[model samples]
Target: MIAVILMLSRGSHSRSHKLKSRALICSVLLWMSTAVMTRSSSTSDLKSKISGVEELLEEFRKQLQQDESGSREDEEDGDRCISGFKAAEERIIRASASIEQGAAFLSAPQRVFSWRDCAHACCSHPHCTAAIIQEDLKQPDDSLRCYLFNCTYRGRSVCSFSFQPGFSTYSRVNNSSRPHEPGRGSTATDSPSLDEPPRSDAGQDLVVQLPTDWAVLDGRDSTDDHDIIHYEWALVKGDPSVKMKVTHPGLLKLSGLREGIYTFELTVTDTSGQKSSDNVSVSVLAPAPNAEGQKLFVYIFLDYF
Candidate 1:
């Protein structure tokens, strides 16, 4: 009976050891599964974050491209506007070549605008086929008048335009159907007939006989202000010894003149500091043979008397 009891105790100890071993194996398996699940969750989160960053980067790139394209388009439009207006100015000037001194055409309502503003205004207006800028000599530099016209009118002198000087006209060609009527909405009146003669006293070439001794060269400007007038003379060509002495405003004296063709320039400056120059050609003629014989007789009579 003692041997049977010892054997039963050894069997019970072996079963307990087996059960403890099985529990330790189960705990190890549960720990490993928990670690794998945590690792998988971290990988998925990292991938999702990377995808979000890539999408954001793509969006930013697209926006940058759009901004660059828009900037280029704006620059192109500005260039075209300037070029168009410049072309118009050239065309109008050529068309109004018949007018002397200043150009006059059938113009639209006058608008106070700058060169660039005038260009944009012409582009925007439906009836405006052309544009012109006329500067007021009496007004300051900042004050400029813009005239828009649908049709061009040429063959008018500055006198017909109410003595207004410094008028410039510009035009743009439209391929659309039907051009606007001339003088319909024109603020400027109809110019007088071309048959009318221009003013004789108006600025013209000076033709005079060279003096035998000292010749007084007189230059006159019709400017309203005489106090602010500044006179300048320069010998453009001909005799080098010829000298110009400025006596006063619009007055020059030639002291050392010879018998030859001499070209002299007379520049007049106004109160606004605007300068205008006119070239005068002087012709000096030698004394005639008959004049010397007549002078000798007159001198003999004077001596005898």
Candidate 2:
């Protein structure tokens, strides 16, 4: 009986040990699963934050690129303006040459078309085709043939308004009160705006007022002996006027100039001739055909920011 009882007790002990081992194994697997889930959650959160930062950086970079592009476009506009001036100069030269060619036709008989006299004749009639190359006409009977043109001399004077041709007479054009139009001179249609400083236009820029007519800076303040020029400006771009008088009479004066966008720089000079400068910009409303030719000159009050 004792031997049987001892064997039964040993079997019960073995069953208890097996049950404990199974519980320990289950607990270890559950712990490892919890750790893996937490790690995955943390990694996902980190990735999300990194993506947000990248997106913000991309936005900043795009803004920077846009700014650079705008700068390049402004430079291109300046170049185009200069090119327009050059083209206009060429057209004047051609028109002057055509005048000479027409006058040469007039002097076929006596054949002495001085540029001065011929130019005068060509400009007499509003729609005259040719000029009287020579004025020493024998009579009106030969005057018709005197104005005949046949491109003979194509010299450098063809484009030269400065050419000194013998002697001549200048007459009123088209019976108008205005004097004979002088040969076209170079026209500068540049308008400079002097309102807000250039540093103000960052995101959405506001319109700036320009000068009305011509504004001359006599160096010093109109009243004071102070020579330093400081640009303390405000935006009057929405108004229309040639001259804008501010409450501060001794400050600044705006004038009407050509029409166009103008970048104005205030050149500050001391008695020692030391110089400093501040920059601002304004846009004058003008047509696309003449935008490059438009000039706006604005003045800013100095001594304030």
Candidate 3:
């Protein structure tokens, strides 16, 4: 009986040890499976984030390319105007200078940030053959002021140079254009060379019939070495009721005339602002009776006799 009891107790102990070993193995397997699943999920999330970053980088690259292309186009446009122009150092003109007799401003003075910008402005204008730029010491950015002009007197370039502090002059280089010759001993104090004024020709006086109430005043023969830019007509002594119309520059049409003497003065200005004046007279006479009407009246009187 004692041996049988011992055998039963040993068997129970062996069975309990086998169950505990199986439980330990199952716990290890569960832990390893959970660890593998967690690692895989983390790897998928990392790949998604990497894809997002790559897409953003591509967009940024495309934007950068577009910006570069636009910048290149802007540079090309700016180059078109400033390419054939050259600048003269330390030579410019003042607004109040006596140079106004031989030159006229192409436009109002413009404020710019650099001399290059001023030069570009001058080149852009069709009539601008020269330009002057001066730095403004009062401005915080040290900005520049630009003045554009054709600088011609009697069809010749009157662009003379003188010493001016913080000033530069720019002129176009063209085979057809004349070179600007600086005057000898030209200084800030000396007066610039002057040119002859334009000549105005309000053509020969006219005689018109009273039935014809209109006259055409011709000033097309006005003479200027530089081109004529403006023509002004005034009724110095005429019928105040007369109407004057400018058909074009240096040409005028007069209307509302009567049997009287009408006098007009033509003042012509050239590109260099030099002007000359001349006068013309138009005499409107009473119209003669119609010859046919007089003959008809004579026939009617003969029939009455």
Candidate 4:
């Protein structure tokens, strides 16, 4: 009976050892599964963060492109508006000068910073043909009073100069090929026939690459019924150091041009003493960099990123 009890105790001890081994194996498997699930969750979060960064970069690039496009459009519109009109010579008119009839005032005088600003204001109106800018000593700049005019009455062009002191005028050039109509109530035999003022053609605007220091201006296309006795060329606005010379009749030579916009005026006076003027602009651009230098710059820029 003692031998039988010892065998039973050995069997019970063997069963307890097997149960402990099975429990250890199950605990290892549970730990491995938990580790795999944690690793998978970390990878998913990393991928989600990467995707969000890419989306943000794309949105930033699109916003930059939109801003660049808008800026380009605004620049183009400003250039187009400013280049449409021509400025006349500034002259002082005393009380002896008579004001022309049929001058239609467009609106009340507007305060502006410069004559260019006044011209821009006039360009905003559809029927505005001319602008008069009056200088005011109280203002910081010469552009103080701006007067807009239609310069047309009924179907005829009856606009004439009234030249007031401290005032300058700018008129829109007629780009159409049509001729101007005759003046009001003037008969054929009125001593000096009321002829149309000479048309001054300052030629098309020009753009030149730099290192070029000279340019030619031709006003040979200016037209008048009578002989145009005088042709005058003046630098309206630009670098004041530039030199000008009348190389021939209705032709001018400009030298020492810099990388900036230069405006020139061409005035033609006919035998009847009637004068007309037109403006032309020349834009000088800086030279482009060498191709090798550009490529090197691009490479350096990319490596920095």
Q: Highest TM-score, which number? A: 4
- By lDDT rank, best first, the candidates go 3, 4, 1, 2
| Cα lDDT for residue 49, candidate 1 | 97
Rank the models by TM-score, top first: 4, 3, 1, 2
Count of backbone clashes for each model? 0, 21, 4, 0
The residue-by-residue lDDT of candidate 2 on 54-115, one tens digit each, is: 99999999999999998887555444322221111111112346543432222333333444
- Tell me how many residue pairs clash in candidate 1: 0
Poorly placed runs, candidate 3 (over 4 Å): 1-41, 65-83, 93-104, 123-127, 136-141, 150-166, 175-215, 219-252, 257-305
TM-score of candidate 3 relative to the true fold? 0.44
Q: What value of lDDT does candidate 2 attain over all alpha carbons? A: 0.38
**What would the C-alpha RMSD of candidate 2 be, to one decimal place?**
30.9
Question: TM-scores of all models?
Answer: 0.39, 0.24, 0.44, 0.45
Better by lDDT, candidate 4 or 1:
4
Q: What is the lDDT of residue 174 in candidate 2?
A: 23
Model 1 spans with C-alpha error above 4 angstroms: 1-99, 104-213, 216-219, 222-229, 268-275, 291-305
lDDT of each: 0.54, 0.38, 0.74, 0.71
Error of 4 at 58 (Å): 1.5
Query: Residue 246: error of model 3 in Å?
Result: 9.0
What is candidate 4's CA lDDT for residue 234?
Answer: 89
Off by over 4 Å in 2: 1-13, 82-305
